[model samples]
Target: MTILLMLVQIIVLFVLVMLHVAYATYFERKIIGHMQVRLGPMQVGWHGLLQPIADGIKSFFKEDIIPEQADRPTFMAAPIICLVAMMTSLAVLPFAKGWVLADINIGLLFIFAMSSLASYGVVLAGWASNSKFSFLGGLRSMAQVISYEIAMGLSLVGVMLMSGSLNLTQIVEAQGNSILGMYLLPQCIGFFVFFISMLAETNRVPFDLPEAETELVSGYCTEYSGMRYAIFFMAEYIGMMVMAAIGTVCFLGGWNGPFAVPFFPPLWFLLKIYLFMFIFIWIRATLPRYRYDQLMDLGWKLLIPLALVNIVVTACLKAMIG
Candidate 1:
């Protein structure tokens, strides 16, 4: 009975996440369009509300193309690997107190592990496609994820130090006890580093060299088409939401707002997540892509070193406060 209940929960969350993934693209297009002072998706439905539904149908019916010489198995499996890994991270996130799918002590670490695993999908997709552009993009992405991932992980050490636990729920509670009611005030350094790393981790603006259309044409998944192509994009957006959720939990006081909704307590949680998503779209609209060399240098020569310093400083402060 317990197992069956858990399975039902998983299915529901997965469906909700897929719906969010679809609407996120619509939101991005509309946000970017408005940013550029143009009407976005007006023809689809009432300011493009139903655009995501149309897109879902279109992608479902589109032809699935594969390179004649491509490694069919790996090519087919890559997007599924990437998408599944990302969606799994949502399991441990605390939407509200005790509302998590899995309330484990090492939930934070599980998320980090899943994120690392997602990189393998990118690597395989590029190699299996057998295109030079795809291969180079994949290699670049592998290196990019590896480099910035170090910075991102190290930056979060501060949050762990303050919370005194790897459980994300405890982290939010820790922020609540703080006078400012958010780690954003005290963990400013970590927050800054984490946000920078988040953008790079998600292959968002200023760090999207892997898919820079001017150079790589389409990056690691360049050979994918139709639903397979849609899957890769779904993974990207879901990955964005996951990172934003982490930021919310770690820095923005996950679900800890000024007031709680009487009947809908998770309202605050959803609002914070949406705010972070908007920022993701905002940056993509505003910033130019970083050059590959500059991107690497930022990760290695700057963010990592800064992350290291933040860890040391955070640890010292926590020790002193106690």
Candidate 2:
């Protein structure tokens, strides 16, 4: 019975996440459109509310085009690998009090591992495509992820040290149920580094060198089309949401708000994720992509060092308090 219940929960979570992934695209288009003083997607069902549904249907029906010289097996598997890894990370996220798919002790580490694994899909897609542009994009993604992943992991060391647990739920509980109890106050430097690293990790604007169309013709997944392409798209949005959720859980105090919604426990948690999502979209609309050299320099020379310093400081604080 317990196993059956878990299976049901997993299916529901998958459905909800996929729906969120679909609508995230619509939301980004609308937000960016209004940012640029335009009405976005007005033609698709009531101010573009149904646009995501249309997109999913269109992607499903489109021809699955494979490059003539592409490695068939790896090319086919790459997007699935990316999508599956991102989706798996969703299982460990604490949506609200007592509301998590997997409340394991090493949930945080598991997410990091899954994120690292997602980069392999990008690299494999690039290599398997047998296209120069795709190869370059894949190489770029590999290097970018390697650099930023370090910074991102280090940035959260402070959170783990302070909370004294690797479990996501425990981290939230350690913060207490108050707006003032959030780690955002003491870990400002770590948060700054983490935010920048998060942008680079997800390949968002100002750091989106991996798929710079102007340079690499759509980067790693350039040869992909139709449903496979949609899967990659879905994976990226899911990655964004997952990173945002981690930030909310670690720094912003997950589900902690001034008032509670009786009917919805995760409302505050969802709101924090939205807040992070809004900033992500806002950055995309505002900033231009960084040069490859600049991106590398920012990650290694700046963000990583900042993250290390944050760790040292956090350690000192922890020792003194103890």
Candidate 3:
């Protein structure tokens, strides 16, 4: 019965996540469309509500093309690797009390490990495509992911220190009694660094050098088509969701709400996630992509040191208070 319940939960979360991904694309287009004073996907369903479904169908029936010079097996495996890594990370996120798929002690570490694994998909996809543009994009992506990932992980170390545990649930609980009841207040610098790193981690605008369409013609997925391309898209959205979830869990007090609203912790969590998603879209619409060199410099010279200092300051403050 426990196993059945776990399986059911997994399936339900999977469906919800897939739906979220589909709608996220629609949401992005709608938001960006309105921002640019144009209608987006008005012909599909009501206000283009069904556009994601239409796109899914189109992708399914599209021809799967393998480039003559491409490494067929790795090219195919890359997207699968990307999708699986993102999906697996969701298992450890606690939506609310007793609502996690896996209440692992090392939940935070698991998420970091999974996110790091996701970069392999882009790297392999670019390498296996055997295109100069794709290869260059892949190299850029690897460097970016590796650079930002260090700061991203370090930023969270402050939370782990304050909470005195690696479990995500405990981290949330720890925030309930902290100053301002959220890690964001005390770890503001870390939060800022992590938030920017999240943008880079998900390959969102302002940091989307890897797939700069104008420059690299879709980057790592240049040679991909049909369902393969769909998988890449799916992985991208899932990564966005995962990053939002992490932001909620680490900084904004995951599922934490006022005592007056204790009955609906999940609502607060969802609200925070949606807000982050909106920020993601808003930035995508507003910011220009950063030059690759500028991006690398920001990640290494600025964010990383800020994250380290935030961790040090947080630890000192916690010890002083204790």
Candidate 4:
């Protein structure tokens, strides 16, 4: 009975996430459209509210194409690998007190591992495509993720040290213990580094070298079409959501707010996640993509060192205060 209940919960969560991922596209387009001084999607439904549903239907029925020269098995598997890893990371997130799919002790580490695994999908997609553009994009993604992942990991070390636990829920509770009710102030440097790394990790504007259309013709996904392509797209959005959730949990005080609603405990958590999402779209509309060299330099030269320093400083301060 317990296993069955868990399975049911997993199913429900999966459906909800899928729905969120679909609407996330609509919201991103609408948000960016408005930012650029234009109406986004007004065709599908009232104010284009149904656009995401329409897109899902179209992508589902669209022809799935495979190149003759492409490695058929691996090409088909890459997107699945990517999507699975991102979805798996959601299990450990504590939506609110007592609201989590997996309340494991090493929840944070589990998320990190899944994130790293998702990169394999991109690399595989690039290689299996048998195209130079895809290859370059994959190579770029590999290097970028590797570089930024290091910074991201190091940046969170402060949170780990302060919280003294790897569980996501405990981390949030630790923030609740803080005078500010958040680590945003004390771990400001870590947050800064983490924020930048989050952008790079999700391949957002200025750091989307992996899929730079101008040079690599959509990067590693140029060859994908229909549902396969849609899967990759969904994975990207889910990745964004996951990163937002992480930032919310680690720095913004997960699910903590000025006031609590009796019916909706996860309300604050959802709002913070959307706040991160909005910033993502806002930046996309505002900033130009960085040159590949500049992206690498920023990740390796700037962010990494900053993360390292933040860790050391946090350790020293923790010791002094203790």
Among all candidates shown, the one with the greatest lDDT: 4
Q: What is the C-alpha lDDT of each candidate?
A: 0.91, 0.94, 0.91, 0.94
Give the higher-TM-score candidate: 3 or 4. 4
RMSD of each: 0.9, 1.1, 1.2, 0.8
For residues 1-322, what per-residue lDDT tens digits would candidate 2 score against the true structure?
A: 9899999999998888888888888889999999999998988899989999999999999999999999999999999999999999999999999999889999999999999999999999999999999999999999999999999999999999889999999999998843487999888999999999999999999888889989998999899999999999999999999999999999999987778789899999999998999999999999988999989999999998899999999999879978
lDDT of 3: 0.91
Off by over 4 Å in 3: 259-264
Candidate 4: stretches off by over 4 Å:
none
Q: What is the C-alpha lDDT profile of model 4 across 213-293, one tens digit per residue?
A: 988999999899999999999899999999999999999999999888799899999999999999998999999999988
**What is the TM-score of candidate 4?**
0.99
TM-score attained by model 3: 0.97
* Global CA lDDT computed for model 2: 0.94
Clashing pairs in 4: none
* lDDT of candidate 2 at residue 266, scale 0 to 100: 94
Comparing 1 with 3 on TM-score, the higher-scoring candidate is 1
Best by TM-score: 4
lDDT of 1 by residue, 209-266 (tens): 8888899999998899999999999999999999999999999888878987888777
User: Candidate 1: minimum summed lDDT over ten consecutive residues — where?
Assistant: 259-268
